[model samples]
Target: MKKVILTALMSCIFQFSNAQNDIRIGGMLAYGTEVENIGIGVNAEFPIIEKLTVSPSFIYYLPKKVSGVSINWFEFNGNANYYFLDEGNINVYGQAGLNYTNVRLSYDGAYSGFLSSAASDGRLGLNLGGGANFQMGGNILPFAELKYVIIDEGQLVLAAGVKFNL
Candidate 1:
């Protein structure tokens, strides 16, 4: 079941790649409250129409200690962003999205206890921030954004990365 879904998703992504013009791929470093640790992510932006873009991103949070267990967390997000300022080489946008979060817990002690446990949850969030695209006469744009996520809890994320246009 998972393989089928993954294959279908890959197929759709390839099709979208072939049909899009303003596609950007980038990586980011993130930190938040619930995450409890620094995270890393990669994202791709596909322009659906003028001033509108759909971005899919994946983030993996570093393992952190909670109680007596080590927890690993990650999330997948799909966001729809609308650009209100798309003039020249700089663009500013507001984003809203849905996220699927997963967490894995494990205990490290003399006695192996609860060897495996995982939990997954989904949430809808909004990113109320804008970023500047600095086009240095190339296909790469350096951008920085500060966004707050409103979900089960509020989290502030600051991300800086270079986007490759394809």
Candidate 2:
């Protein structure tokens, strides 16, 4: 099931990129309020029309140790952005999307070999947010975004990154 989902996501990414000549790819530095930790993400943007785009991103939160347990978290988001303001050096947009959040655990010390459904959680959610992009001198564009994912407990995420136009 997981394989099928991943395959379809990848296929969509490729097809989107192929259809758009101005696709952009980038790495993001992200912060998740639920995890209370910093993370890294990779994202791609495919412009569909003059004022709209499709963006897909994956974020991996760094593991945190809590009482001999290591918790790992990640998220996959498929979003759409509408650029209502795309003038001059700045582009501002609103975004809405779907989110998938997953968490796993690693036990250490006395907690070794312990496994339970409680140690892992995966959920599908919804995302709503807005962002702005700053066009630099050339192909590099810097951007910042804030989003809320309505999932099991809900989370607020902040991300900033630079995208290179392809």
- The C-alpha local distance difference test score for the whole of candidate 2 amounts to 0.90
The candidate 1 region of ten consecutive residues with least summed lDDT is 113-122
Highest lDDT against the true fold, candidate: 2
RMSD of each: 9.1, 9.0
How well does candidate 2 match the true structure in TM-score terms?
A: 0.82
Candidate 2: the clashing residue pairs are none
Error in Å for residue 122 of model 1: 5.4
Clashing pairs in 1: none
Per-candidate clashes come to 0, 0
How many Å off is the CA of 13 in candidate 1? Answer: 18
Go through the candidates in order and give each one's C-alpha lDDT: 0.76, 0.90
Candidate 1 error regions (>4 Å): 1-19, 111-128
